[model samples]
Target: MSEFIVFDLEFTSWPGSLEQDWSAPGQLREIVQIGALRLNDDCSVVEEYEALVRPLANPRLSPYFTDLTGITQEDVDQRGRAPAEALGDFLGFCRGLPVLSYGNDMVVLGENVGWARARGDEVKNGFLSATFLNIRPWLNFIVPETADANVGRLWEVLNLPKPAAGREHSALFDCYSFTAALKHLHAMGHWLPTGFL
Candidate 1:
């Protein structure tokens, strides 16, 4: 069965970071978590990958970020790998498979990689060659009203039963939400976007 990947990221953010586009001093979208699923043509799970990345630029997880993502500072201190290591593992997992994300999260991934290299951290992965197809446009094409619904809210916004047991915001749970929406649209006869299958 041919497979592709769907992924999400949880990043460092402050109360006003999104509004400011994370332009505030020392506020970068350094990834804190990466959640991805590899799925076959039937939309069945083929494999799963999750990585917790220790933020370098903003080593501290703000209260707003923790509240939003449910990832505690202790989690990173305990299990988070350096961003370079985490990113390399994620890229290796991709293995050049076609990748899909709710938005242009690849940019954030790239920014993290770039920052790591600038800090003289070793990042040995295919990140520069990695690419992600934004599924938002196609999803919104199916249900125009849901254009604003993120991967976190896609299930609820579609009024579909939740596909898995997990809270939104955490990257892995959000990935399931993305899959749920795709399955719903497929059941309604929409095709997986061209070139991604």
Candidate 2:
């Protein structure tokens, strides 16, 4: 059975800390948390994973980031980990399952790879750079631009049932919403083509 591994990542910040550290060419910032739901060929939820990683870079959490994601400094201080280790753990769990992320969040993943290299990780010998399923581009190709310009806003516009609101910035919450959106679109007869990366 074909399964889709839908995921969402809560980052260290909005613009992200790694953006400024261009010296870390192949590394990306730390993922504060990662949540994913594995969907069966029938689009039924088969499995799920979530983790809170300890931050390795910034000593202080940005106020804006906290406001946007609702993840407090205390939460991060208590849980975040090194970026390479977190990515390794996440990737280990994911295995060979295809990843589906919202919009340009994959760029964040790219940043992760760079950050890993900067931290002396082995991502350079790992998965290729374009190795993620970006749901935003797919949605854009199928849905009209007027529907909802922001890929992040797809949940609000599509309004998939069963994902309780108010968990917006949480990784697991976003993953659930992403799955709901895909299911809703499938039920509406929108088909995702094979071999789409």
Candidate whose TM-score is highest: 1
Candidate 2: Cα lDDT at 73: 83
What is the C-alpha lDDT profile of model 1 across 111-149, one tens digit per residue? 988888888888876754555788798889879978888
lDDT by residue (84-192, candidate 2, tens digit) is: 7667666765666677777656677667767778778774234542256666767767766514544335566675455745567788878777776777778889856
Question: What TM-score does candidate 2 get on C-alpha atoms?
Answer: 0.79
Candidate models: Cα lDDT each: 0.88, 0.67
Kindly report the root-mean-square deviation of model 2 from the true structure over all alpha carbons. 4.2
Model 1, residue 57: C-alpha shift (Å): 1.1
Model 1 alpha-carbon drift over 4 Å, by segment = 128-130
| TM-score of each model, paired residue for residue | 0.95, 0.79
Clashes of 2: 14
Global lDDT for candidate 2?
A: 0.67
